[model samples]
Target: MSSVDICEKHRQQSTKTSFISFAFPYSHLRPCAHRCKQYVVGRSYLLQLQPKNRRNSHFSYSCEACQTEARSTSTENNISTHALSFTERLWKTYTNTATLLTNLFPLWTLLVAVLALRRPTTFTWLSTPYFTFTLSILMLSMGITLSPRDFKRIWKRPGIVILQFCSCYFLVPFLAYVLGRLFKLPSDILAGLVLVGSVNGGQASNLCTYIAKGNVALSVIMTTATTLGAIVMTPLLSKFVLGTVVQVDALGIAWSTIQVVLIPIALGMALNRYFKSFVDIILPISPVVGVIATCLVVGSAVAQCNKLILSAGISLQIPIFLLHLIGGICGYFLPYLLGYNEVVCRTVAIETAMKSSAFGFVLACLHFTAYRVRVPCAISVVWMSLVGSGLAVFWRYKPVQNLKGFRSDLAQRLRQKRQLDEMK
Candidate 1:
């Protein structure tokens, strides 16, 4: 045990005649508040003396660990008086900047979209390969943030997960299809809109949920579930929705989804499970990296679709905007109508609206080469980002409460004001 415990045990075992002695260094005493205080004079035989009982003979004991602890504490106190190293200060600054950018994800998306539109050629360099790498990194970042606790949440609240999947996969895709037909969009635009809806939940939705103070664990689980399901669902749903208009390579898109979404996320989860320490170091800056990667992906897609956007004008942008707007509103209200909490409503809304625009863009580019399928996905990256982030910011500032509660709170405030006026 410890030195104190050892001394106490010795005292418990000793007779009245027995005594214990401890010898401590002079230099360690001044710096260590917990250690002995008495000092010896003029090179005395002992530094300090404490005896439980008087005896002719006594034994001395010293604890190396206690001495080492005292010396280390003194060193730490001394070091606190000095300035931090350049590298340490630099890391602190870097983390602060990264955290700030990470929190303002929507702003980053908007900036990237505007920049991409203004200078398409500048961001055209972020090609297909770079897009995949960026998305893979983003998914990896998401995976590292997950834990067993997140998975255990499934059993705890299976209904929320089920409702989210229904909203994300079924309700959203149906709305997209209906909107495409209602708008009487062209074949290419219709296909693009449907494909966007058929894809997995947005990469940034979980982050937005966290920012909004919603159910982050639920968000993560829903994203992961939807992403994993996308391998089968995305291609099948796209084919079902777009088959009559154009020939869709469902198999090709499925394999792409596997490569783009499933594998990277799985790899990330594994790393988090097996290599947590490495993941811990990477976690601090991973969100910013993901956001930067998202900006590049969205920007590059927008750049590539610049001509299409300018020529199509509102015809293309309107459908994409409507799709996300409808998705976000329906996702929230549907869950709320079902009597779920405000947190679940917010989480589902974000999840439903924020489809994987990058994944859709990649699929459109790879499968529907002749058409401007990527245009809708690119536009969606900007639109849904603005919508989702705006909603999140609103929820962040406004506390979610029912109308009855609000009315009650307002009445209470009015009563308090009346009391204060009477007192005055």
Candidate 2:
């Protein structure tokens, strides 16, 4: 019926006779007419057996067809095994390296920022054009991670999206204004603080969201939406907030946003959709590359403003730190008050707190003349990154819980129902 069945049947017959002799020619490749047993030992078939009574007890047979087939099968198997092992080894190496790089992100950014501040010349080589290119690459990496399915989630939950947008635009900007006024900051510093607040969410917020076990898809959508809106919102908010103090060039900032941020993201999405196989291989490394690009952008900014920073006192640090802290706290509490779950709250909070400070630094250098104008944004990159990373690390080990209002609201409803029953 089958080779295995035939081999099993012959194996039983072989056990009956201690020895049997059967022989066949190598060329004929056909079974001999004489009745004989056939069995398989290992990979090759055993075609003959001799009776114990015979002088020569060992049976022998030759068939070039069976031997050739066995040899060919074994050779192919060896090659396939080697190929599979090599591929698996390569994949493991890639994933291990990528994971290492992703985990070391906080260290990477902090180290680059400290080094850049200490030795400005080391990072000054990242000029304006190279800086913009690097940002585009970072944006492109972010884009490749997204898909059409991710965008559909945005439409599915418009309320969450709108709430995050409001927090990004209104809450952060207003917080910056209040902090600036309370600190009694100079005109340039105030303008820079407001400008940083008005810019879109930074790319690093996605990493923080992932670390915190927040809604990563929501974080990506929020970043994408805010960045697209920044073309108009950043300039308008800056002009409205800072116009009294400085001559704001709204047009220039809009053009820069379009050129640097939007196009790269679009290109990356197109490439991911079209060249999925290639992207899969590159995707693991993209985050690490993005981290390096971000470091370069921050380092360049620090290098540019090294002198102003060394001379400035603690007065400058307080406002920037407060801006991020206030924004983060407000972002969480407002959403929690509105009855959102903890995941959404965490996502919104991170997006609100981590502004595109690099974009702010670039705009400041382009539009503002005062050294103080660039100082807040330059320092913002360091403090916001540290604060966000700390929150992410804390959240990673902890479980997310529902807002306090969830229990309070349930109790209030129970009370109202009891009162209605008593009245009836």
Candidate 3:
């Protein structure tokens, strides 16, 4: 043909070749491009979807699609890593047998004490200074777990603690007395039950409060304050309730309580102040220690079951023990009706039901050689623990309807304020 035509044909061929080469890759890239476009759109949609001011910095759509994907993958990895670490720690702390032992120590101690009672001659050492020393160790551990900061918080909000003490000292005792008379329980069993009801809250109160999503700080303060107060209040209330049946040495009981509860706790708190690190290290182990003590105490009590049965007779005293359960349930709910919140009500309820039965056991051993009086104390420890723990678990997972209402009110108020500011 012509030179110009040939030049034109050559140009067309070059253009066609370039188009074919680009098209081959372009077809392969379509899927990736589409995915990138979709990811960008999805991110934008999510960004626009968030509540005002609630969108996090990482959630912003300023990055390119590839960068956004990388950021999301990083965030997911971080979240999964954190979650796994948390679960591992939780399993190590709670699911382990060591932790269970810590939680059940008190029960075990009581059990051992009771079993030793079966052959009092064989385990005479339990009645010696060693028993007192062991109890003192438990008290000290409890105190170390507490901080002055807890007391300060309680001082700021004293209402709940005061209410808990009132319910335990006044209301519960009155109910127990009235019920004991109505039930016509055996004189010894009634006396023991009344004494148990009159005493302050147990150390387990803190654990239950924590489980129930109640105020741990408040529970701790109440436990500490009431424990100190119990030295006086327990005796006076006991005298008032049990005086008709048996003479109670109010001052003597007060001294016993002080020796058992106050001295150990004070020693622990003092040590914690001086050796803060030691306290911190032992704090986690405190629960384990407590569990062992509990188990020992329970086993000891159980070992004396024959004596308890002989002195109190299961039939006669079973009714009194039942009254304790009923009284506890009543005491727990009454406070709720009197305008107290769930946490305070739970604290009061548990405190009202469970006494330091270990103290009661000591008193029974000192005052009465009869197993009848001690029977009630032995039963109190196991029953209160089982019931209180059940209640705590129930409350912990209970639907948080009240919190939802509070959040709703807060949101409404914020919306109103924003509208007002706009008008201004």
Candidate 4:
């Protein structure tokens, strides 16, 4: 029992309850506030808290909790503050469990990859079409969570978004090409790396941004912009980069990307806009659903290419890891040096580093000239998930106390301009 409840237990049952109610001199007291909730006992008696009880019209009442502590010999305080009630405890447990599961995204992906390698039959049963369907579902889950307001965030800081877009599309792809070639990987493996680099940012980046306490709204905006642009960008980049190595089916890739990624996301946004009530009901579970879909896609890809992955070993693995790690490093430092806030730096880094491996896998499987290309996509999924999530967890503990950055006058001018715009 709470100390207050225990002390008030016996006295409450009896009509004559003695509470400490002091009458202050008029000058000593200000106005009485209801927030104190100091007069329950006094009200019943109509003797301590009432106006007639006042001499110079100044009555000061003690808190019930304070009265309980003063009267009781017990040391425990109220359960509301120091202790949690049944429901409160239950809710806390549930949230903690959810956060734990959510943060372990890398573990789940890695475990499934290991299992797929050891026993391909487990995930191999889920065919290419299933992976494709799941990717569409993942895209749809992201789409449902987006609204016009998400797009509007771009207008608030067009400069940051533009920089982020350039970083994601330009820096990552260039890094992928350099790493793939510098590692002296085979033509198909190089193609795979290039394909993964060309794709849009994954929905997973949004989750990581949220975990890192970065600009989640900006992350979502960047994700949406790139995803919508992927239809054109993915095919063109693939054709240009892989033209000599493989007969790139630019048209096929574009058409399939539209069917797999664009259609579902557009449909989802339309549903969210037109059927908001239904969307609200499912919105809470969408992120979990997206995670499940993402896991399935990654596991399926890894299982399908287990023999190749086993053969490639670290020779292939090093480039894939560098593809993400270097991309993320460049993503963060570019923004930081240019004077973006830490939150923006984190958001841009995650978006740039984390490829839509699921989407890349689908495209590589569907349209690539060589089967080995899909192997990189599969491994990229595993590596990017690990790298992005690891960075997020590392940054999560390091809280952002200052919104303004120290590196550049550009950020200050931007902030001042935004303030002026808001004022106007």
lDDT of 1 by residue, 25-77 (tens): 23222222344332211112232233433233233333334555778987997
Tens-digit per-residue lDDT, 37-118, candidate 2: 4433311233333334333433323233455566788899999999999999998998888777876776887898889878
Rank all candidate structures by their TM-score, best first, as comma-separated numbers. 2, 1, 4, 3
**lDDT by residue (tens digit), candidate 4, 46-87:** 344555655544333444555555556344535444455777
Worst 10 residues of 4 by lDDT: 1-10
Q: Report RMSD (Å) for each prediction in the order shown.
A: 8.8, 7.4, 13.2, 10.0
**CA deviation > 4 Å runs, candidate 3:** 1-125, 128-130, 310-317, 369-371, 403-424
lDDT of 3 by residue, 262-312 (tens): 888888888789988888777777777766655555545444554655555
Q: Judging by TM-score against the true structure, name the best candidate.
A: 2
Candidate 3, run of 10 with poorest lDDT: 1-10
The clash count of every prediction, one per candidate, is 0, 7, 40, 0
TM-score per candidate, chains pooled: 0.77, 0.81, 0.66, 0.75
Worst 10 residues of 2 by lDDT: 17-26
lDDT (CA) per prediction:
0.77, 0.79, 0.64, 0.79
